[model samples]
Target: MEAHRIFFERPFDYKYAREYSGTLMTPTLWITAAYVILVFGTKAYMKDRKPFDLRRPLQLWNLGLALYSGAAFLIATKEILSTWFNKGLTATYTDINSFYEGTCGAWAYLFMISKYYELGDTAFLVLRKRPLLLMHWLHHLTTLNLVLAGYHYDTHLYSWLLWMNTFIHTLMYSYYLLASCGYRLPAGFAKKITTMQIIQFCIGLSILAHIGVLKLFTDREVHCNWRMWWGTVFMEILYLTLFSHFYYVSYIKDGGKKFVRDQNEKKQVKAQ
Candidate 1:
């Protein structure tokens, strides 16, 4: 019992978190609108100015997020394992208590709210004059929308999303943290991260399918709330398609040509 308490400590009011999620839905939409405008506005404002050298601040920002994601992953892992062992595999997805109770609940709420803070990633790109891809902003927007809807509807299926996202982000932000600090990471590192993101979306859809099967064939009460289910399905399919196209264009097609050309130039220089 003492050992269990260590892993399942409830430090926050879960009911209040749910209430807050419901109340914040409209405000979140408003904030997202403001975010879109600000992103384009910042880009226009910076068009005539030299890019700000924000390396140090960017390093600190990535470091902070890396740490947060790492910690969230650990907490989520413990909660997931505990539920799986004690309640069974189905409980991991169907248990609303798992979503709104104990340490996991608190961390999940933090994870949902973190979406708002993550808009800063785009701000960094805009201010630094980096090429902002559609995938980047669309990802932020869709994700914020999905998580808020999931929380408001108590979509327990999102427990899987919360866990998987935190795990991927732990790696993703750490990569950013290293690259920001002047580390010469492998050329394929970013490509590999994008590949992993593509894989993540595929796995998410697979989990949704698994829940769908259970709902259709079994009498077991599945919490596959349709309110968020269709939205989740649409977003996951869209992400998978977008990320796959990005990988093909950036790595397998144009990027492959660029890499080979750069390599040949290096070899010619060495030979001379």
Candidate 2:
């Protein structure tokens, strides 16, 4: 409880964020660097070795992520709506304290922190020697940076984007939970998950685009943190293109073809 008070209960202060002075930013940088080094180093080290059986661990990891994402989604939704109903929809995003200082604030902070744990999904693949996609880690790294930047800036965009992202993660991690256990989820479910992600990015991009237009069209300057605003928009575009390509190659052109295996093993290896 004391720890929570110190870490979670405290609201973000833009004064502290003036120069990236926070618990999350430096650690995010160091960890991401380490993640890159270890990914390559471990791959070379494991080239000649047999793949370790990580079925049970994978199951546990995915299940844990699924549960956490679901909880975060619910908490953020309830608090945001409460703020909207009690305060007003217009102020819900515009007012920093209304969006960031309370239960809703705690969950928003948690949502940023949760991206670090999601990085573990890539780690598990590295350890298990699964075929890794470069976009996976790049997306993770860029997201961590953007989320921290967005949160530190205390922009309305982060609040909306975080809520949407939490919902997507709930579905994504649940799908991973089933896949980790080797259960054959409905065919093409992975494709659908990617499609959902694409849609979220599209919506997110639109929101950011509108912000840009406001910055341009309005005579009075819009009070946005330009640092994160442009970074977020760039990343959204990059991911939108990358995910669309991944979907095309994985689902459309390939016709959603998955790995093949024997009947019993099929349930254990190929799903998502």
Candidate 3:
């Protein structure tokens, strides 16, 4: 199949200057550098300043996340629609790759840069004197790195993962935004969002597993870069572990009753 042939043939243009040019490496380097400088600088400045005002920055962050989620939804919907109508995964992959090669590629790069923007979420926590959770920082840093690596390797599964995450982040960030605005959604709904993230990771793992199976079992010409495959697998495993831990800490541990009681008490204090 032509689709299988394209998959087997390395998608990268081998000309070093050409392929690596317009890739994520240069921009990611610059963004990561800027983020480090900005975050540390802001942290230092906040040491002598009044408590960080959560209202303004949180509003801005919410808006940014909403826009990003919207974009992801569009991309994912397009891919799913194409796949449904075309009657096969191969065609869907090819069409999506073409989109990536053209416009989606640039958008992905922009999203990679946005990871640096997201570091401000932590800066906000620091300024507000909120305790920084290890999972939060790990997610931010590793997610940025994953985006960089995904682009560098041009992993075929990346498009699918991106599509799913965009959908998930749309919900997750929207919730954060709303909660920051002092709107209390149902606790169960919030928990479900985290659950959805865990599921997303699971789905991503499945895609990687499917690709591995294809390579192992069949004479199919499907080819995947080993680095990309393992990078994705490792990252997904890390995410699963972290998110699962978060779920346990937030909901399941201590019978979850204590957790809810504490949350309600906090809410009452906030209201008072």
Candidate 4:
């Protein structure tokens, strides 16, 4: 029991550091292997059984998302308010490295560790036989890498990205929670959620690019925290591209057109 407590409770300790790094590789590989096996195994094992009912699991997922988003929001708000009002914006803004390492360091480490917990999201998708898009898995896998790299470098600029992501996730996960509870939000709101994600990526990319430029041209001896900067920029670009494709396919392509046509047909039938 003590060993279990140490393993599960104190995951952030350096003695267990390799476990954190191993998370970047192990979860994705295990998830992928499990998915492939299940895809094939399900065909043989439950050919006649009814399809899996995902409602309960989805609700659990929604609850998890709510908790994660709430924690993220609280962390971001605490950092922002303390930095902005108490310490002055310029000082807080300029010295992000110090802020993260000193004030919010432990929380950031906790959040980073939580990424491993989130691997369960993909596990549910596989269990439900949901199509595992490359973007989905890539996002999960690379995010683990990003968090690990960010901690290693202790990058200051990452705070802004974390803050913005926390805000967006509050909405994103709330939407998921509502949907899981069988509440149908407006179609416009769904579109807005996608738009918010896109905007997050755009803002994140711009910030990293700005820092990169500053490193290039300025006389100021800017700290080149390459791990955080490059990892974030690369991931943001990938997210932007992947989400743009998903949006186009979901809202503009042949599938989207067919969906609209079907809705119109149903409406006409009801009118009759």
**Alpha carbon lDDT of each predicted model:** 0.80, 0.72, 0.69, 0.64
lDDT of 2 by residue, 1-272 (tens): 13344353246533343234256678879988998898889888888997788888888887887787788788778867886888765444445465565566666767777887788877777777877887798898888878876777677777777777878888887887776665667765666788889998998887777777767776534446677778888999999998998877666664545322223355455543
Itemize residue pairs with steric clashes in candidate 4: none
Order candidates by lDDT, high to low.
1, 2, 3, 4
Model 2, global lDDT: 0.72
> Which segments of candidate 3 are over 4 A away from where they belong?
1-50, 90-95, 219-223, 265-269
Q: Residue 119's C-alpha lDDT in candidate 3?
A: 75
Q: List the candidates' TM-scores in order.
A: 0.88, 0.84, 0.79, 0.73
Residue 75 CA error for candidate 1 (Å)? 0.6
Q: Is candidate 1 or candidate 3 better by lDDT?
A: 1
Q: Please tell me which model should have the higher lDDT, number 2 or number 3.
A: 2
* lDDT string, candidate 1, 1-272, tens digits: 12233235456666566666787788888998998999999999999998888889999999888898999889888877888989887788776576557666777888888999999999899998877889899999889978987876777877878888888888889988887776756777777788888888988898788788877788878766765777889999999988888777767896487556644563554355
Worst ten-residue run, lDDT, model 3?
1-10
Error of 1 at 240 (Å): 0.7
Most accurate candidate by TM-score: 1
What overall lDDT, based on C-alpha atoms, would model 3 receive against the true structure? Answer: 0.69
Clashes of each: 0, 1, 0, 0
